[model samples]
Target: MYVAAKGGEKAIANAHRFLAEKRRGNPQLPEMSVEQIREQLGLAVDRVMAEGSLYDRNLAALAVKQAQGDLVEAAFLLRAYRTTLPRFSPSPVVDTGSMRVLRRISAAYKDLPGGQVLGPTYDYSHRLLDFSLMEPEAFAANVVYLVDKMIALPSRIPRLTEIVGSDDLVETPQEEPDQDPPVPDITEEPLEFPASRSARLQALARGDEGFLLGLAYSAQRGFGFQGHPFVGEIRMGYVPVEVELPGEDVKVRIGSILVTECTMLSRAEETGGCPFGFVQGYGLVFGANERKAMAMALVDRALRSRELGEEVRYPAQDEEYVLRHCDNVESSGFVQHLKLPHYVDFQAELVHVRRRDVKKSQGADDQGPSSVGSAGEG
Candidate 1:
């Protein structure tokens, strides 16, 4: 009689059609081009790049659109896309020290040979919202440009960390790590004892931005206080990528991508070392994620005492504490699982509790005369 509710399917199709139309908006109006999304929605793109662990801006922008502006979802999409792509060979490491940096700032030494240059940061910007963006035409400001400083950045190719041994400015290496696959692919392999920093950072880089922020916040609020962190360097720019020729000593440029690399030069607290020991904290992410990079750096330094021959006392100092919980898929699923229905079990528990309480009350009521006897007996 009510049309047998037959329009539900039609209604769903109509709703989807409406949503597509709404997402596109008026045909006469300026269509939201991927270029527009890339330029205007850059923060979203940056976030995607950071957690996605890939640096393609256009694809990141498209992900932002497909995700309906949800940055985390966009990042997940980007990462998913990256996972299915083919792998040819490992790329040659780019030297960050020689990098043509766009933004470089060092905290360890204010007047170090290369001075601090903050390029395109919202660090000092006022937190006020601009409603004038409502029209979208009133936003215009002068853009600045400058060039300076260089610091070496180790690449992922040949396990280059061996090139510069532990905190020692100079150390003799037995030999370079032979060209081969990374030792751990936690994505495919299970995590085991004595986790590597490379594996830890690999997980952290693709971790949930907000969760990392919270963990980093914990360190700042004194959950684990060792030393103050200075923005040693945060560089955002393209670096030439390379692929080594298999069975040959030659290396070729594969492509270039934007990245944010942060190195925190902080003083180690006097736990077991001299009053202060200089330590380095490193963070490398896909896009210009200064905050995440800086946070990761701080956490990185805190976790180094174990390797530095000092006792690891704090939770932040535990490699397992930091790395085990950094994954987005793992963490979010666990936290959100609490929202699943448990009401049926809860109701049974409630009924049992009420019955026990009523029986106890009835017994107590029957002991009314006993209450009077207790006063006299006392």
Candidate 2:
């Protein structure tokens, strides 16, 4: 049966007002502030910022609150806001080597030059929840000491990749001065096939964390992946951003942003029948999102199957599939759109099903009970 649509304008307005009421919940409880979400629910904000491809923590938190903690929807809101903002000059390449290191770890080497500074991480913590956090105690002075130590730490730490660079064990692609083309901005153009390494990296940087995480895990489980990959290094900290304005020769520091960087080393066949060695895959993302950074790194390495002369037979290894579907906003929009009114489409499908059943019934009646027994006997 087909249903008629009614109460178009007023019904929508009433629905919106009802939604507001539901979102508010009990009026007795104090409403949560955006700042509270930004500071307290920082990890959620970080995920939103990373996937949304925007770096504003406050706005990301606001989106989270508005979306009722639905992270994908929050990311969608932030991305929509990003489109309305005016384009400014691109920032200079960030120097992670000079980062004020907060947390740094190396799975490849235990004793490196930096001596594995475990600044702030949940890796060592027990999984048990501390109910005391429901009413947290006052902050202690050790936290202050930790912050001071982070600030006073030497400006530049030697990069692990740099140490191995001279050895030529990893396939490091170097940029030729005045010879290499500028990296394509994935945001400014549609993603085309046979994408450049830079373009793939750009797309993966903002891809959905859960999607990347799953694909990365699949790669580790022998799906279009070869050998075990080691985390060369993972670092999380604030790196200063600088930009040179138009018609100005000097560059000014535009403040710092918290970022996580991961470098993964996977086995690679050497060129010209040389000995086997490791190739690096790099991942960097906004805010302290180590999981996303690591996942991105794994996916990055998997996507390099073609360049590495490896078999490309899995979804994780397919650049077009990964890049096209990893976008949470686009995926969410398409999937969620099914919730919209499909009255006409449903009616058409219903009519087709009824007609099919009627034809089957008529055919059965024409054969009758005698025909059914004769066919069975035959």
Candidate 3:
């Protein structure tokens, strides 16, 4: 048994070596670099950053490569790395209205103050794969030249919600009171039942994409409120981050980061003194993960059951249900842990079952033949 155990340890070491070799398959071909992944496979890096709750592109790319292109695993690796970093003061609240817009679109209105700018989207593209990507140089050259020739987008674009508010068609966001309420940080505190909006948003922001997408779909398909929702606006751009130093009234610009923001409008019920109108659900995440933002917006709206005076019958409407199960790291770890050795537990169960069976057999044998014959006669 000792020899077998030693052999198993050696086998595990050799398996890791084999995996490393396979990850770098061809020596003749150029080795895949972190820069290449960041530049070319940008969407994957964006997902890793969003789900990992960290916004470093280079680190996300490196994690992607290390995970052998498994996006969830890459996100897990990035999240693990994030836990080791020193904490700093939280950045000032982002002003999405002042974002330097690259891509902006509104489904609610065709013609708004700012024209819809479709930037770097695959929405209108044909689904067919282009084999020409095999020749990288030509494709890279054309893309670079096209980008160089393109005009810079306007620094500020009017949001669709702003336009809609002019006609008083939607309820505007409530202004802050004299005393700002304390916003709960889910990362620092253990999640409890009846989460605050801040905590809910934080949970949804880092949730697994597929899981959120599924819940969003289920909500839309009449499982939840089933209110008609329209994408009021979807914008992708870079927003400047600012941080206020200790004992200072002034704020300093940290850096800029690319983000995608979605605003969804849903049907609102008429209440006392308030006319029937539209309510908003908002979502924002690092990088250009539009689908995640959109799904998040939908789920966010669904989760407003109590505030919106809607029935909380569906899974999406339940705060504890969604927030508790949305984390990919927690779910994946528990599921994968099942593969660990269970021999001792199984052996214990085996012994108990055998003992129970022997007792039952002895009880049957102790029954007399006369008792068996009388039973048969009856």
Candidate 4:
């Protein structure tokens, strides 16, 4: 029988109190508001929401502030809070083609339909910091005025994949009656391999950005797939969210969300029982996370090696390995749990080590002090 230890409860409580005090820091300065975090540190909020699998911006911001800027901890907090809420019916599929185009670009062609709309980005900025931004005068005018002269894009922009598919340049999955399978939700059911493409995509969407980025880089550098894939298109904007009323047979647009999407084009193997044509990988993420979206697209393609009849020769191609370790919360918990007390197991290990050392010492003593001295020296 296991007995519960007593008398550490006060210490734990005091430790928590100390943590809260430390998190506040510098009482003279005004406390940061949740709204400020929501508007200013939006990227961090977006990451927390994406990884937590929750879509509430205000709650995500609150989590970030409560966790004191530790994004993973914020995600953990948000995820824990998410479990208490009741889940209603799933939302209908989002249509990216009808997204309000704030930013769109393509690497396949010099210019394409809808043109290259470079929205808020640091891509062209010099790495050196501009001290002017620190001045009070720098906040004089909002940056939105700079783009006021640019013409607005149409309501619906054509996807590059659709164009390529129509021209027979890329292998488009047919939507035949038998081929159209229901998408599995990774959050609802336990993941198993060989996982369906939809399940893998869902897992990837909620995966750690840093882990996915590293894996995607490795794949691009000849670890899984050879040669670089082209960014067919990358678009970021606001997309409308809709949900069908239960038993009403009608859908309603309740809100809109900012999202980033990418499509990567790669050479497909002909042995997959299809004609030689380019294949595409798709990625969509909440918020304007272009790097994560691009990385996801690349890794998504690498994970399709088995379906495309390519050899699974690298880590990126292994679905089970990728999906299982992709969740940062799970990985962090397993790794950090080692800090907890393990007195009994550690004591046993220590006893075994001491006995082995004593046995070695006795053997050395049998061989005289000379051997003992040599053993001690070496």
Model 1: lDDT equals 0.69
**Whose lDDT is higher: candidate 2's or candidate 4's?**
2
- Clashing residue pairs found in predicted model 3: none
lDDT of 3 by residue, 71-140 (tens): 8889889988898998867787888878888788988888867788888899999999987798978777
Candidate with best lDDT? 2
Candidate 1 local lDDT, 1-378, one digit each (tens): 011223479887988788788777779987788899999877778888877777789999998887778776677678778888887776765665555555666654465444455677887889799676665555543322332443443332121232234565322223656775565766667776577876777777887777677766776666664556666556776667888988999988877767778776655555555333456677888767778887787777667767766667677777887777777656655666556566898999999999999999999888898796998899
**Which model, 1 or 3, shows the larger lDDT?**
3
Please give, for residues 1-378, the per-residue lDDT of candidate 2 as tens digits. Answer: 021245589887988899888877899999999999999899999999999999999999999998889999899889889989998787878989998888888999888786688877889899998665565453432234444445456778867776665556775545668866787988779889999998999899989999999999999999956889999999998999999988888899989999999999988744324233887788999998999999999999999888878778999999999999999888887777777788899999999999999999999999999999999999
Better of 2 and 3 by lDDT: 2
lDDT of each prediction vs. the true structure?
A: 0.69, 0.86, 0.85, 0.85
User: How many pairs in model 2 have backbone atoms within 3 A of each other, for residues 3 or more apart or on separate chains, i.e. clashes?
Assistant: 0
Question: By the TM-score metric, which is better: model 1 or model 2?
Answer: 2
> In candidate 4, residue 370 scores what lDDT?
87
In the range 204-228, model 4's lDDT, one tens digit per residue, is 9888999999999999898876666
Q: Rank the candidates by TM-score, best first.
A: 2, 4, 3, 1
In candidate 1, what residue range of length 10 has the lowest lDDT sum?
155-164
Cα RMSD to the true fold for all candidates: 6.8, 3.8, 4.7, 3.9
